[model samples]
Target: MKRIITVESVTEGHPDKLADLISDSVLDECLAQDKRSRVACEVMLTKGKVLIAGEITTTAKVNYIEVAKATIREVGYETEDIDFECRIHTQSPDIKHGVDNPLEIRNKENTIEKDIYDMLGAGDQGIVYGYAVNETQNLMPLCVNMANAITERLTFWRKNKTVKGLMPDGKSQVSLSYDGDQLSGIVSIIVSTQHIAETDLNELREQIKSRLINDVFPEYDLSRTEILINTAGSFICGGFDADTGLTGRKTQVDTYGGIARFGGGAFSGKDPSKVDRSGAYMARYIARQVVTKGFAAACEIAISYAIGKAQPTALDVVVFGECKLSVAQIKQYIIENFDLRPAAIIATLDLYNQKYKPTAAGGHFGRPGFFWET
Candidate 1:
């Protein structure tokens, strides 16, 4: 059977991505100052205003407004176009109590467990899924990888002035036809970009086709692929000026791009203590390892947790195409070899010390230099 899969990515100048970037920048600052900081930062953006609000427990002295403004400016937006508001507060004592004294210890069920990994409970209850495939060099789906590459190329062209009058906000989509597990051909490519008022739509399209698309997908045969650029005509107004952006809104773009199942939890602004963020990272790590070790051609794993509990409530895996080991056996191997507790995940990935700002805009899982990606 033939199937079509599509995935999309947005530039840092996109409104929702701007919010994600600002949120993660704050998280990065907090972690830089206090590695033990428990941060859950959120950001919202709209015309002429930016609102920063979240629960945080840290000694880091961050100028929230300045951080937001600087991030916006770095994304090629003018601070003069927006005002900033911050409503940050300390993490709830109730939640902190759970994190400090996990249910496993409080109930005396695991009081004899001497491992420090059992002490930190999951920050929240949620399911996280991780996926990997052999089709892409980075172990990501080809469509999403290509989509993100397109957006990255757009940013490159805009920043380097290779495309005249190109602005920051942009989006890219890739559609691919698959013959069962094997890819057949490219179906179509779509690009929407914001530019200055002086830019001609036809010229911009030619430049993108010649410079951006050709440069990004030189290996693919696009002679039969449909290329759509700025289908809605001019995009003179974009970013926060024309759209409202909220943190965690682009969960699909941040993960497997809908090719694999996701738990619907956003990864931006939240620290690793939040299982929604760390657990997902761990799941991805496991799936990538499974594929890397030749256990499966493709893998997707789910790990679910309960609030205030150190142990995962459930763990499951699904291997696609061919697998050397049964799913049940692989699941057992993971249980024996990996520690799914919140604290263990944190220590294993060294989540606190790493930078998160770079992850805010791009898809998170396949990026190089990230500990989880390794």
Candidate 2:
């Protein structure tokens, strides 16, 4: 018997995603102004409230509250529907370690700076996996593709007013059946959406079925595939009003969607110095290169680090038993060809100055036009 795999995605306006967006927006702003800024920011949202907290070291002075509010408004939330204003509760403290120099001269001006930029020290020690498979054209799993298609369509319809009265918050789940190793058919699709209270459920379902679902999966047999939209009832109030949200809670959604193992580190609210963020990006870049170069049918790269260390403790490669080269050879190639240090990865990928807010939703790894390429 063939097995089935399922993956899910959330809309950009989903509460958790909203929080991620806010955090990344702040990160991008700081990095845009000060390329060397050290920042770790977190965002929390609830009914009528937004809370900004975390440590930051930057030369740029930002109106953090304005930044938060603007991010919320841009995501389709207005001041009228449960005001999403923010309050900053804390600021980062100065590091007191004396082993490193405290003052340096740049452009003939003396300044207090952290000069440890060779290998970004791990903000916290953990593991992370970067995966790429030839199962799809983009090297992503099919189930995730279906989920992203549905979520993107939802956003598209809302922006174009093709589906009027549609709220921003939504969720999509796709179950794909595979025979042996090849994709067979879609098993089911589930969409939970928020809409204006006055909208008719039956009409909304029909519109979604025709405009969103049918458009994305044209070859799939919808008559046999189970479709559910807001199966419980109407969703009048959503976004931050419907539930509370915190940064870094949607790690699975942000990465490979549970199709592969996770490293238990959140990507948002941390600077590139944290290997949890930069290391993962580097791993994905390497994995993609490995698969694109025809070294393997699929690749999962793992790198482990120690706190305040300049080098990863362990570097590994798993090809799902589909590699033309031996695992040791693949690992040797990566170690020889790529810079695995945290700071090096950050610099190579240009993570310090890249805008990351756009990647907070719709899946981060598979998206085209990443800043690293530019």
Candidate 3:
């Protein structure tokens, strides 16, 4: 029997995206003012209340409430009909310890006070994975690429006002049927979009089908495609109003869209000191280089670090049975060519800068160029 694969994506206006935007925005602010700042902020959103919580150690002063409100307003949730109003609450204080300074920093710097006031380490210790596949031209899988394209076009039309009555909150899911190793056809397309209260559903569906969907996938015959719009009816009240959102909830979307295994670590709202964030970025960088250099059909790299430790406790590379070189050789190449240390990854990826917000939406790894560089 042929296998069917699917991938899903959410629009920038979705509640989860809003929370990610706010979290990254806070990160950006701190990094903009102080590159050495350590931050791990998470945001929760519900109707009229945006709760900001997390730990941070930075010389930069950040107005968390301001960032939250601006993010919501930017997503087009300023209407009175919406239940959420972007009001912020206090950050969680429990996770604040390591953000202040870890033991290694204290031992190296001579005192906790000096370490806290000087350098900072990862907020936590954990494993993270980065992956890449040759199934698509962009080094991403087809289903995920299509889903991201939908969300990207939706945002583009909304920002340009080309699609009037389109609200910010939306989602896209694409299921592709694969016969052996080759893609056969699209199995389904699911989209849940919010719109103005008075908009016509039929017309809205037709517009999305004709303009965005049809234009993007012209090679495929969409007559057999299962296109669904707002399967649960009108999505008038969405964003933080309809559902609560938190940072790192969309980790799968942020990475490979379930096409690969996840390390179960969330990337948003955490500083580069955390291996969960930095190691993941480094892993992706390594995987991309591996695939680009013709070493594998797909690659997933994993790395784990101990708290306050510069060297990773564990490191491994998997090629999904498509290795051109031995896995051990790939591992050796990574060890020799890349720096897995938390501080080193940040410096290499330039993660200490204010570029987290743009990554909140869209697939992070498959994008054209580094937004941080731009």
How accurate locally, in lDDT, is each candidate? Answer: 0.92, 0.79, 0.77
For 1-374, candidate 1 gives per-residue lDDT tens digits of 99999999999999999999999999999999999899999999999999999999999999989999999999999988577899999999999999888888888764465668879999989999999999889999989989999999999889998878989999999999999888889999999999999998899999899878998889989999999999999999999889999999999999999999998579899998999999999999999999998899999999999889999999989999889999988998898889999999999999978999989877888989899999
Winner by TM-score between candidate 3 and candidate 2: 2
Angstrom error of the Cα, residue 357, model 3: value is 0.5
Instruction: Give the best candidate by TM-score.
Output: 1
Ranking by TM-score: 1, 2, 3
**Stretches of model 2 off by over 4 angstroms after superposition:** 80-119, 372-374
Ranking 1 against 2 by lDDT, winner: 1
Q: What would the per-residue lDDT of candidate 3 be over residues 148-210, giving only the tens digit for each residue?
A: 999888888888999888889899999999887788889899888888899898888989888
Question: Can you write out model 2's per-residue Cα lDDT over 1-374, one digit (the tens) per residue?
Answer: 69999899999899999999989888888888888667778888998888888777778778877888888888888855554444443333322111011222122135454344532455556787888888888888778888998999898888788889998999999998888778777889999888998899999998888878989998878777888888878988899888998999898888888887768788886668777788888888888888888889989999997665556789888896367888898898998899876667877887866778888888777878785322
Candidate 1 stretches greater than 4 Å from native: 109-113
The predicted structure with the larger TM-score, 1 or 3, is 1
Q: Candidate 1 clashing pairs? A: none
Structure candidate 3, residue pairs in collision: 48-84, 48-85, 50-87, 53-91, 53-92, 54-92, 122-273
Residue 90 lDDT in candidate 3: 35
TM-score for all models, in order of appearance: 0.98, 0.90, 0.88
